[model samples]
Target: MRYRALLAFLAAIVAGLMVVSLLVGPAGVGPVAGIAALVDGKGALGLVMREIRLPRALLGAMVGGALGVSGAAMQGFLRNPLAEPGLIGISSSSALGAVIALQSGFAAVSVLALPGAALAGAVVAVALILMLAGPRGPSLTLILAGVAISALAGSFTSLVLNLSPNPFAVTEIVFWMLGSLSDRSMQHVAMAAPFMAVGALLLAPLGRGLDALTLGEDAAEAMGVRLTRLRLMLVLGTAALVGSAVAVAGAIGFVGLVVPHILRPFVGARPSRLLAASALGGAAMLLSADIAVRIIAPERDLKLGVLTAIIGAPFFLHLIWRTRGQIA
Candidate 1:
């Protein structure tokens, strides 16, 4: 009952935030009218509501949920609270791909090019990381490998941006790296949703294995939890989730990192419960952040990734300070 109640509360929050997201845009559509427009498809208001805000809200929820669940899975698998999707370098690689597409002028030619490139980059990065870490490797080894891959990807991305002849392309690269949901269309939803959904499905069933893993690797192995299979699922699932997110909205960081950590205590450190709670909590957080960016700077463009980093970095520093002994 407690667990259900918690989930219900989170769901209610996400639902309310979704409505708020729909109504909070620069279009000036009232909540009631937006709801009506979404349902009836009546006129200009309907067009704006359905075409613009609806996709944004839906994508926000989906992207947030993806990051949240992915983060939870990573933390559980690694037995580290600080584990996040970006730690594996998939997000940076995806951003690099998008930057290349922008610099090459391919993104201008086709709306799909940017996302396609991002997805490809994520796949390649994950493949290389897996190769470097090897199957059934130590978690520490994987983390170190991921750090190397991320640094390499970031360097390449910077090189591309610096070498671009078009100054406008450089600006686009900055925005893409920072992330946003503005001007997103149904096309992006179509491209990212399936991959994210697949990733979710793959990660969702691993809760039991993760919980058993809490008993340590030998115990988990004795209990029939295949570590190699678990690692495969975690890597592939995280790649899909992070890749699809970067493909659609660029790189919104800290979500997967923050949401699971916040919800872990409430879920009693159970990986299973934390998964769902983190998803809902993540959705709510992203929706709230998206709304705040619009309200705080109605005239200026504020990137979603920038806002999240601003909030997450301080929290992360505090976490590090609190765990200084562990690091030492």
Candidate 2:
């Protein structure tokens, strides 16, 4: 009953947030105006609502779902709830790829440059981590390798920005790093949706493997789970999801981290249940954060990542404190 109530509440919140995302923005589109525009031959309002707000909100759902499920997968596979896409360097590497594309002027040529570079970077990051950490290796070692990769990728991005002759690289990098759902178009959504959807399909079935993995790799292998194949699939799938997300929304952190952790208690630490629940929780959290970003500063507007980090950082510390004696 408690879980059902919580789920219902979350559902309500997400639905309300999505509506808010559609209605509220720079243009004054109130409920009546929005509805009239939708049903009647209104001015630019309906187009704005459809082309801009609709796609942005949809992308938010996808990206959040991707992050949440990926986080669940990472935690379930490692039996460590703290694992996240950012911590594993996939996001940073994807950002580096994006930066490379922008700096090389490919991003300016077409939107494909951005996602293409990002996906390639994501694939590279996962491949490098696999090599460095070894196939089906220690979770801790895998995490450490991820950290090193993040550091390297971050430095590379910084170096690229510094070296780029384009004077706008600094501000552009800031926007990309800060993360935003505003000003997004349907084209961006079209570019990333396939990768995100495909990645989800690839990772969803691995939930059972993740459940078996909680019993230790030896036990999982004894149960006939293919550790090597599972690891490869996880790495690739996470890269695809994280890459598409970062490619579009930039490095919006902690959705993956927070959602799964928040729902883990309800799901009883079971990986399979946790994955879908986290996806729902993540979508709720992200959509809510996005709505908050709009209303919190109706004048100048805050970036989505700013809201997420402000909220997520404190929760992160609390998590570290709470989980201190357990995982660390």
* lDDT of every model, 2 decimals: 0.89, 0.84
Global local distance difference test of model 2: 0.84
The most accurate candidate by lDDT is 1
Flag clash pairs in model 1: none
TM-score of 2: 0.90
Off by over 4 Å in 2: 1-9, 35-42, 133-141, 319-328
lDDT digits (tens) for residues 9-68 of candidate 1: 999999999998889877787767779999997899888888888889988998899889
Give lDDT tens digits, candidate 2, residues 212-233.
9989999999999998888878
Q: How many residue pairs in model 1 have overlapping backbones?
A: 0
Model 1 residue 120 CA deviation in Å = 0.7
In candidate 1, residue 292 scores what lDDT?
A: 85
